[model samples]
Target: MNKSVALTGNEAVATAMKQIEPDVVAAYPITPQTDIVQYFSTFVADGQVKTEFVTVESEHSAMSATIGASAAGARAMTATSSQGLALMWEVVYIASSFRLPIVMPVVNRALSGPINIHCDHSDSMGARDSGWIQLYSEDAQEAYDNVIQAIRIAEHPDVLLPVMVMQDGFVISHAMQNLEILDDESVKKFVGTYKPDHHLLDVKHPMTVGSLFLPNFYFEAKKQEAEALERAKKVIQEVAKEYAAISGRQYGFFETYRLEDAEVAVIALNSTAGTVRGLVDEYRAKGLRVGALKPRVFRPLPHEELVVALQHLKAIAVMDRAESFSTHGGPLFNDLRSVLYESKERPVVTNYIYGLGGRDLTLDELRRVFDETLEAARAGYYRNRVTHLGVRE
Candidate 1:
């Protein structure tokens, strides 16, 4: 039977992990991500769950331990944020290249430089190309469901890729909400067991993993990895359908609200999407033709779904919490533009850098985003490139 309770995004991750019943959990506490690991640690201590929680020294070591456990043919999980994620970069790439299906719950936050503890996409954006399947959650409810679904997607037989379930740092990660908690039996049935066909530490087989590759054959190995990722896109949809069958909660590559006939729309991910939905409601009530699109999954780009959803829109606003500083364009903007490159006719897709470095984005900012995009649609004149919103000189 389905049961419900109020849980924060971070807490819900811990709860879901209990449901998945991982054999080992290696994690070191980091702000925003701390509560998740802490709750799991308590579960470990209280005997509510039979799982090993390895407390490590640093975030780097935290992920390293998780890699070791996962490679040993065990279901492994970990949680981290900003600096912690940055520290895991090198190993993250290794995890994907080695095809280890490790899943991490990342409480998304701004990377340090000026030193901030608030939410942003900087951490995940930094590792976007590290070959992990990136899934963004717009609220605590979605956060709860995605973490469980991520495990199924990552460990699919046709695809063995690491998955990152990203939730907004302070905004959603810490915000309390009513979440339907799946019972352990149902979650177990949904996620299933981790069956590693290629486990490195199989004492019976004693096989090889991550062997050195020469320049001649390195391309072939990478080619296989690329194909596997493409396979993952479809596998994600299948898992989503299966998950809905069991839980009665529907999910997809992206969630659309009044996007079909809308002329202007804003595409966003994470907790901010909830805020944008509210603003879109206001505009809709006033007879303004504006809508919102929340991407449930980011990596592998979901090109077909995105193009179809966006094809009818006149103007589109893309929001990014992290700056691709060197590129002079936000990461989401850069990615969206690339995704739409081959389309015969595409909307005037513009990027908005909002809520960066912990800057507050109120309803006023959401209104401003819709207004600007609508005005551009009306004039039929706007740059087919990145834009900065809620940012002033």
Candidate 2:
């Protein structure tokens, strides 16, 4: 039987990493995400997990160490948040392009300028097009569960890519909860052993980890990476289904809340999606036909899943915490518009920029955005400007 125990979101992530039994845990303590690394460090100290824990001086070095461990045919894991992610931007690309299958837990936070340490998606948003599969978790449980699924998705030979498992900073990472920690033996069997088909240390024959390729060969290889990502859809779905069968927990590309016959829908990511879900429940009780769509898989972007979800709605309002700099759009809004543009019949979609600088969004603002999106749908072509939520002059 499955066991349930109270756990902070950061602890839950660390627990899940232990369950996976990675051969190497390379990390540097960064705010918000530090607890996760701490939990893992203790797991090592207590000898619960038999893995080499590498302590690094900086986030960049942490990733560099992970890359080296991964190249040497070990399952590697790491965690970071905000500017820490920004610091590792260079190798973050190399980690994906080289198809290293590293699993990173990013505690979502606002980027620095005036110096803020709160929940926002600016960091991850900056790296959306960086060729890594991104998964946003709604709560601590999904954060724990998806990190395990990330390993399966990234390590699949047909879909060799790194994965970013994002959870809202204080909302999930620092929050406490009763988390059902999976059994170690079961986890070992599920994740299986670290048997890499290609490794730098393999001596059966000579091999290479990463080699520079000229433009002619690089283009085709990059094209192949796209094909690998496409293959990941199947791998991701199948693994989730199999995991559900064993754990009685179900997951999907995107979660729909009362979307079936709704006329308008609100879209969001991370813990904000949970806030929106509660709002959906409140609106549904009052007979308002508003729905919520929380995307789980972002790197693959779940375009097909999103297209299907949009078919029934007349209008959709997308809430984003990160801005795209003068596009009059957010990262998610821009991508969704492009997807719908490719479709023959697409619903009128409106973009709303909210919760910037970690501004707290209340129930009242959510209701207003939903109501305005519905009104704009009937009025034809709404404002494309960022609708700042809870902003003050």
Candidate 3:
């Protein structure tokens, strides 16, 4: 059974964490993401959940504690934003390399230098290669749903990697939205219990974690980790199918809206997808052959599926919320273009970097992007391969 609720994205995620009721939650406070752990800690204090909430000194300590708990065979979880994630960079890799299936909800914020606190993919996109499975949510509903599914995905035997669920800071994180939530028992049944086959506590095994992997074994160990991520694609789909059966909402690698017969489309992630979806319908009503693609799972980069879905389009504009500073284009654009290179008839793809430091992406700017994409479709090539949207010149 489902219950209709009005809650902020952070509240929804905290509520989900309360339902999952993991063995341990080790976290430090950071803007936007602070409320998630704050709310969960209250759940622990109130005795609603018997979770061991560790109040760590720093984000690094938070992840370190989580890694320790996960290594000790406890179902561990954590949450962070921007600098907090960057601070945990070292342990973030270790968590995955150690095969700890810890789940985290990251409220995406711009990485500091200018010291801005707002929505941007820079935080999560910066750690794209750290071996954590990444799931980006469009709004509060998806954020809540992804967190629940993350537990199952991370704990899968074949893909024992940490998972991070991302929602745009202050945008989706603070905005209140109406969303459907599964009953507590239903979520518990869906996620099940986390039972690892091996852990530090297993006296019979007596295996050591975080042991030095020298030249002889490091390569093979890394190869195995890479293989596990590849295996996760299938496991993710399987879990989505089961989740859909229970939740009545179907999920996939990337969602396509009016894309089947469209000649041009815009691809985006996070909250911007909602804007694109609305624009897609408006464009369609005007008899324009336009569509949208929202990538749900970013890491493990579903290239093969994306290629098949996009190969037919004449042009595409990939809206990136973070700049990769590659001098070529944003991170999503670079990866997407590289993948499409394998297609027989490649689409004229362009990159549009937007919404950095929580800057608003107005509907007018999006309309222009779609218009440019449509123009490129007819022109057979775009004037500029890379573009910055909504930026002050």
Candidate 4:
């Protein structure tokens, strides 16, 4: 049985966290993400959950504490956003390098310079290569669901890596939406328990977790980490399949909307996918072969899966909420282009950097993007491959 509720993304995550109720939660306050931990603390104070809530002073300390807890064989969790994530950079690598399955809920926000607290993908996108399994949510429901799934995915025996479940700041994080929540008992059963073969707390079998490896062994260890990431792709699918048996909501590396026969399409992540889906319907009604691809699992990269979904298209546009500053294109665009390099036939893909620092991406602009992509597909060449949408001329 399921219960329907109107809850903000943060609240939904907090509710899910309460249900999962892991052994530890080490969190520091950061906007958009602050409410998630704040809500969970209430659960702790009220004795609704038995989680040891550690209040840290900085995001680094928060991540460090989480890593420590996880290394000690405790199921650990945390949340952060924007500069907070950037501040945790050093420990972020350590968390994955040590193969700790720490789950983090990151409310995406722009990295600071001019100092903005609004929604953007820069925060998590910057950490795309940090060896964490990343999941993006289009709404509060997906956020809650992904967090729950993340626990199982990260703790899988084949993929003992950290996970980051991302939601757009202020957009999905603050906006309320009606969602179906699974029963607590079911979530608990679904997530199961975290049993590590080797943990610092296991005094009987003493071991060093963060031991430094010399050059001879460091490279081999990195190769193993890479292999673990590849293994995670299968584990992610398996966990999602198992979760679907309980939740009735199927998940994948990415979602396709009206893409079966689309000649032109836009690929995006997070809440922008919702907007794209609406426009995809409008375009379909107008007899345009346009669709959208919303990537949920970002970290494992899902290259083979994306190639299959997009290889048949005539042209495609990748909308990136963050700039890679490569002067070439954004991170996702580079990935899509690189994946198609070996294909016999591939779409003329372009990159559109949009919605940076919370700039609104209008329907009209999305329509223009699709129209431009369709034109390029027809022409069989790109006039300009990289563009910045909604930016001042």
Winning model by lDDT: 3
Q: Relative to the true structure, how large is the alpha-carbon lDDT of every model? A: 0.86, 0.86, 0.95, 0.93
- For residues 169-198, write the lDDT of model 2, one tens digit per residue: 988888888877678777677777767788
TM-score of each: 0.97, 0.97, 0.99, 0.99
Q: Better model by TM-score, 2 or 3? A: 3
Clashing residue pairs in candidate 3 are: none
> Distance (Å) between predicted and true CA of 79, model 1?
0.9
Model 2 — which ten-residue stretch has the worst lDDT?
380-389
Q: Candidate 1: what lDDT?
A: 0.86
Off by over 4 Å in 2: none
How big is the positional error of residue 68 in model 4, measured in Å on the Cα after superposition?
0.4
User: Roughly what TM-score does model 4 have, to 2 decimal places?
Assistant: 0.99
lDDT for residue 183 in candidate 4, whole number 0-100: 95
lDDT of 3 by residue, 246-356 (tens): 899889998999999999999999999999999999999999999899999999899999999999999999999998888899999999999999999999999999999
Steric overlap count per candidate: 0, 2, 0, 0
Candidate 4 residue spans exceeding 4 A from truth:
none
Candidate 3's TM-score reads 0.99
Q: Which ten residues in a row have the lowest lDDT in candidate 1?
A: 381-390
User: What RMSD does model 4 have?
Assistant: 0.8
